[model samples]
Target: MPSAIRFSGVSRHYGNVKAVDGVDMDIAEGEFFAMLGPSGSGKTTSLRLIAGFEQPTAGDIHIFGHVAQGLPPYKRNVNTVFQDYALFPHLNVRDNVAYGLMVAGQAKAERYRSAERALDMVALGGYGDRKPSALSGGQRQRVALARALVNEPKALLLDEPLGALDLKLREQMQEELKSLQRSLGITFIFVTHDQGEALSMADRVAVFNEGRIVQTGTPEDIYYRPEVPFVADFVGSSNVLPPEIMRDIRGVDAYGALRPEAVRRCDAGHDAWVRNVSFLGASTRVSMQVHGVAMTMLLPRGAEIPAVGSTIQVCWQQDDLHVMSR
Candidate 1:
């Protein structure tokens, strides 16, 4: 499939600081692609460049085969749903959604029709006349989305769209957004700092660091076979162990990573004493000291919780170990 958005050797700078450094990415048509990273990782900057909010200091951006370097946000075939929602206070939900169409010189009837359809697509039907201040956070976000979708852009860029919402609302919106994307069949370029959000929603995720993309893959690939130590540690909980190579194993590096779920409590194995136990609702997490290194393991709920300072065995299959270079 042709790329919906492409960044080729892209770099952006603020004086000497490299806000986005040499990013090369292709977001496939109709795919839910997420840029996941911490603050200052250039994820948002990359999204802005695609949205034509910022020009690249070097290289090029292409949206649907057109060079997007000089195009303004409105000229490009895209819309952005920002973290703040950015609704017009004076405008009701319908007017806010119809604003884009109206600006494009759409007829009043056509604009309202498009806005109403967009609102219904977001499950906010019959909410057109309500003011932004009168709606809840989630409703306001839906209004912003309806506004963006009412234009029927080729792609949608979301810059931390759910960052302002509470945890429960965030999760709810995540599912809603994913479902909306599938139903609309439009390419979505989502930016977020939350790993869980990306893992749960994106079809594939690009992990960013220090203004560069460190890794890009499916959530399973990012979690189970992270090529770099940063990807392993950043995407999920992992216990990085010191380099210990066994001669019999092929393609095995000296350094190893074990996910908490991969490590199991056994009656016999390498000796370890439990240092702490955290009883999560679904599972019990136990931290242990083995060979002077701390390791964590997850036991299923209802399993005998190990007491702190009690000797236990920690065992894992060689296949379960992820070997990566630092």
Candidate 2:
């Protein structure tokens, strides 16, 4: 498949500060891609650069084989959904959704028809006449989404689109957004700092840090086989074991990474004292200390919860060990 978005040595700067520094990446057409990182990590800057909201200080950006350097956001074959929703308070849901079409001078009747369909796509049917303030946070978010999708852009750039909603609503919208993306089959370049959102929704994810992409891979790959220490620590709450401890476990002198799921209770293995057990609804998080090294484990619900200060044998398979630095 051809590239939907491509960046070649792209850099954006303000004075001496580099927001996006020499980043190169490609998002295949119809792929659901995510840019993930902490605050000031440059993921949002990269998204804005793609949307033509921010120009590159150096290098070039391409959208569907066309150079996107000088094109205005309207000229590009994409639309953006910001964290704030950016919906017009004065307009009803219908007009807010049709705003883009109206700007393009689309026929009023036709735009309204498309707006209704778009609203229905976001499960907001019959919500046409409601004012922005009348809707809940989730509903207003759908309105913002409907507005963006109504334009039928080739790709969608989302900058923390789910940031404003409560947890349950955010998760619901995540699934909805994923389903919508699959149905539309358009490239979705989503920017988010949430690991669960990125892992659960994206076909592939690019990990950003300090204005650079440290690693890019499928969700499983990013989670199970992080190549860098930052990625291992950031994507999920991983235990980065010291080289000596890793060598003792794996017979190799290298930094080791293990997910919470990797460490498990066993009948025969190294002994550790359970420090704390946190009940997290569907799972129990176990914090233990082994040979003076603190480690965390995630056990599924219904498992016997070890009491605090109790000693237990824990073991992990060789396959679960990921050597991050050698």
Q: Report clashes for each candidate as comma-separated counts.
A: 0, 0
**TM-score of every model versus the real structure:** 0.94, 0.92
Instruction: Supply the global lDDT for candidate 1.
Output: 0.88
Best by lDDT: 2
lDDT of 1 by residue, 196-314 (tens): 99999999999999999999999988888787767877886777666553222334545567798988867677788899999888999998887777778889877788889889877
What is the C-alpha local distance difference test score of candidate 2? Answer: 0.92
**Residue 141, candidate 1: alpha-carbon lDDT:** 88
The number of the candidate with the highest TM-score is 1
Model 1 lDDT at residue 235:
86
Candidate 1 residue runs with Cα over 4 Å from true position: 244-254
Model 2 scores a TM of 0.92
